[model samples]
Target: MTTATATTQAPAPAGAAAGGNTLAGTRTLIRFNLRRDRVRLPVWILALFLGTLATAGNYKELYADPKDRAGVVETMDSPAGLAMSGPRHYLDDYNFGSMLGHQMLGFMAVLVGLMSVLIITRHTRTEEETNRAELVRSTVVGRHAHLAAALCVAVLANLVLALLLAFGLSGMGIDGIDLSGSLLYGFDHAAVGIVFAAVAAITAQITAHSRGASGMALAVIGVAYVLRAAGDVGSNGALSWLSPIGWVQRTYVYVDNRWWPLLLCLALAVLCAAAGFVLSTRRDVGAGLRATRLGRPVASDALGRPFGFALRLHRGMLIGFGAGLFLMGVMYGSILGDAEDMLQDIDEIQEALQEIGGATIAESFASMVMVIITVVAVVYVVMAALRPRAEETSGRAEPLLATGLSRTRWVGSHLAVAMTGGTVLLLLAGLGFGISGAASTGDSGLFLKLVGAALAYAPALWVTVGVAVVFFGWFPRASAAAWIVPVYAFVVGYLGQILQFPDWMNNLSPLGHVPQLPAADLSWTPLVLLTLIAAALVWLGLEGFRRRDLETN
Candidate 1:
């Protein structure tokens, strides 16, 4: 009895085990992240507002007449237009404001969603991948707190965008444009942005890698757009009801002005955020609910050659991009195929058609579609060219360079795939668009016309690649320089139509000078100029890379 029993002790509580979780510390981290992104975030918000204001100005000028408005409504009411553009109800006054709203609102929503996706993924999956999450978790921060902080920042950014859009549009002298309604429209879009951000957050919790999380979120955005489009075109308004984008569109600003739809968007956003938070708590640090399985320890035959290894690494992205472009091509072609029939009922539309048409309606549509396809093609090329920088920053390129492979061969292999793959992707997108347009028109020759138009964009696309390569080689610290090249092109090409930018500024974009194929006659001088520029830039980049130290971080 006197013999002391072995002393039993209880384990310390997890509050004492790891550390106590603190909401205040997490809030401080949020502020730190916000401070780090001060310049970038403000610029993005300003851009969003400026884009909306510019659209308002452009629409006011383009559709100043009632006849013009009516014609637009009639054409938009068609199945194809409805699928591509959304319902045509607000086209009645040809309320130029509403027209701009209809044509550009979806894109704005997507842009905001993209911004959200990138921000959330960067803070969540990216931080986890870099091992920063473990360090943060060692403090008093809760498992779900990081996500909450990230979401808080996203919501704040979106709210600023909404306010700016409302303020900007109000200054444009748009008639009967209710400030409350417009703000609601912006808010509705912001809600969609928040929901997608939440979706991205949830994806990060369920996927261990940043790429998978970002891809998953983007796929959802794409699916939502498709579903909403299909539902709108099919006359089954019910289907549109199922999409968050549909909720934003259904708000019907300057028309029915149904504010209730916005409430639905807010609800969805909240629910998604709640679910994401729950998921974050259930998962462990640096691990996802859907764990990333290990690949084969041994290399496959596909990984045998330098080129083959490049292909293997990029195959998934390439296939995904091609498929997306193919689908977009088909949808665009199908929509434009019906444009002629849709416009026949409206005199103003007929006049507009005459303004835009060539020898035939098919040719005119082909020209417009080609311009779109070319822009998308250039985007793909830019993305491809930037892959070298991504590889270097990710540390994948170092090992490859450490081997017998020379820097020229290593960089050249990636560049070769980028150049070749970009061309193939553009061709496929063009062919898909052309074939679909031809099938709708019941004409076999239309394929050649469409494909040619698509190919016409190659020079401009090459210029974008060259710009990226130059940045990658000369300014390794500024990986984002490549992004600016395309952004400058986009601003010059599209912003001119919306805002009254200077002539010299517009001429800066290669697309601005590229002859509008199938509409305008092709000119060789501009093409030659673009080719020379691309070649010069590539040479400069190569020389810079050869002389510079191989960047390790």
Candidate 2:
């Protein structure tokens, strides 16, 4: 009996146990986050890296002569060029390195920042929305562990990308692109990405939904870009200093190789991250600082219908994308009036314009801009079409389906919105482009021409949405694969012209089949064929979804 006596120990109080463990499981979470993003991280990093290399190679080949390089300075010195590219100061040096810094750095930095924002939103707010963060926190995980892991993973991804960019450019052996300049260029991208990651962390605390968090962060990036663009085009360069994107652009990689601007980026990152940590302490697990908009006390009659419900869900996206595409069209059109004077001296561009078979340089440029606008509209199509899959995975679809709502009608509602909404987006874009082109060139005919050119791609856009439907119906888990349609289209439609890819390569994309309107002829044959293909794909997807099981969480 005496030997059987044993001592029992009580566990420590939770408050005491978690006092100094705000980041207790950070390392484990970081490793887990890395594993989750393994494939995605590599794809983003590789695409950006390869694209940079290809662009650099193209520039080198295009401007092999110093005199030809000087012609580029003339185009880039203008206000439109400054707004689209970077500061005009790069024109003073006008060499290979300066060209890259002036034209590529700001654009690449924005992409890098977008990458960071998505990474943070996916790992932090997305997990919380899905209720995974609640489970993670019930264990040894700390309040800040999830955000910390997200930030660490973003930092790691950016660092790897920066290293690759630095070493790869230095190894290219370009005349003016030396190691020091390359290092500055690479690290500047990393700094911009880090700052955005911190911004996302703070935004994640504000919105309970992942989409809201990512949207807020992306809006910040867009504002920064606008500020930088406006400031760069202004007489005095002081306004540029207000933007993080401009901060990195100010590094002036090959021109001045200034390192001080990087310090500003780093300081902002630290301050934002600190604020995020403080905010996390104030919010509860699986909850946002700002509560989600409360639903109506009673459901409306419209909410009962599939189409109405789908419209409600997609309303925000439609408004945001419509406004964005319209603005983008205006921006691209503003540059069209100068296409002849700007591109005539650049032999490669002239060759590309000729390849498009335009009667005039401006028409060829309009055709090129149409490709960009159509591709951007396709982004909206894919996202809207894939909304059903997101709902299913989030457990919302199961409840709606448990009622009398048929699966076909439910899915069809979303697809309808996606298809019709995309067409409307194109219409807005065309109208904006036409208005701007007519104003800029003082020719009302140019407005109608550009509008028709933009609308000509609508059939291609339908095909894109059809592709997304097929994936979502048959391979719900692999629905994201549909993005390849738009991505490939962009590569073929835009870069294919620049890199001189074979016609066969371009023809592989549905977009390639459409006539380059206002540049060449407007042929209805491809449009008819494309419309038939789109209908067939949509019908097949609906049938497949009817036969398949619901993919509810």
Candidate 3:
């Protein structure tokens, strides 16, 4: 029996199987996330690839002449250019395709970072916060599945973007398309997105709430972007290389095309994701690594009021957005002197600016800046107006309504804050720009000029607020869809100009109807009409909200 006995291997323990089941439900969760983002992801992916194609195609025509190319190279290397588009050492070689890639590399990275943040927040903390995770977790789902699925979708989106960029650039028929450089360029963008996805994942674990996680992650991005801009514009390049944005730039795709630096992003992403997974395992469900502290025991009298409560909830986000716009104003103001000189000799650039906004360069600059600022306000207004939906979904609205508060009064309170906040944010942006402009020019009049210009966008802001209110009233389940209004405005205002789309297409933006102030006359007719229309929409919304039941989902 001993001689006939065969050696047998020990079976693995059941605990080992359980330990390996952390990703058990990842595929199902991924499908769920994808379904939720079906429209959103494709819209964004299409925009990314289309923007890349447009940039590649347009630059060939925009910089066909060597003289024009030289101007681009010179302007891009200058402080303003460096700040706007980081030092694209690739432009030193004067390849139009490379310059095109340089133009959008950082901005595109930012867009993807935002996308990643929103996606992760939607899945992880949001699910847990809303108790959807509880039901899902009660099943055969794994603990790590949600975060892993979100990351997987983001990575997939990035991969698609990279492939699109590579293919789009290759087929554009531009000279020196350099497939290696183009593909590497695409890879660089993907790397930046992956790093930010990891960053969002880690942030999602550290804060107990989704809003806190989003705010913290966005703050980090803001700081990193500023740091990169500082380094790019600084005399020494040391600070530039420290930023992830700068590292992406340092790759100098299409110039040296060196890929060694990309390893930095990869390493950071791996470490961040690993840290997030480890932290997630350590924390309890629906909780964070850091426990939240209790608020003050006594509430202020003002906090009892609806407007005050709305203000309190939104104040921090308002401050964050205001600070960012102010910094942007400062950057734009700093560049005015150089922008004038840089575009002075280029007839095409001057013509484009004139067609884009005002008769004079200063007026055009102010109008364009306000147009962008107005888009920011649009987002703020929409988010503010939809706050009540968040409350309703979270069951907080039930208590408030139970207190005998009228639906109209409650909804009106939120709208009031939203409309007022949008106005205040615009003022802050205007003041920031005006003060910066005045400082740059040593003229007090510029402040009034810029401030007035920003105010002209008020009607546009009101319309966005109205749109959000309408959604909140009738389609509370889809109130967040109101954000698409700003997306449309942003695309039309910026991308429409680049692609030189038809006038009818460009005029679709509410900002488009506002007369180019300071450069062109400010007409009262459109403003009055727009305001009336916005008021009508609000009236309709209030009536609907008053009649409908509070959204439970």
RMSD of each: 4.1, 2.1, 4.9
Kindly provide the TM-score of model 3 when superposed on the true structure, using C-alpha atoms: 0.92
Candidate 3 local lDDT, 270-339, one digit each (tens): 9999888988998888898888888789888888888788788888788888887777777777665556
Best by lDDT: 2
- Ranked by lDDT from best down, the candidates are 2, 3, 1
Q: Which candidate would rank higher by TM-score, 1 or 2?
A: 2
Local lDDT at 48 for model 1 = 82
Worst 10 residues of 3 by lDDT: 11-20
Each candidate structure's TM-score, on Cα atoms with residue i matched to residue i, is 0.88, 0.96, 0.92
Worst-scoring 10-residue span by lDDT in model 1: 13-22
RMSD versus native structure for model 3: 4.9
lDDT of 2 by residue, 316-404 (tens): 78987898889888887787788887777778778889989887788899898899899989999999999999999989899888989
- The model with the greater lDDT, 2 or 3, is 2
| Per-structure clash totals for the candidates | 2, 0, 0
Q: How accurate locally is residue 524 in candidate 3, as Cα lDDT from 0 to 100?
A: 97
Off by over 4 Å in 2: 1-19
Judge candidate 3 at residue 347 and give its lDDT: 61
Worst 10 residues of 2 by lDDT: 11-20
For candidate 2, the lDDT comes to 0.89
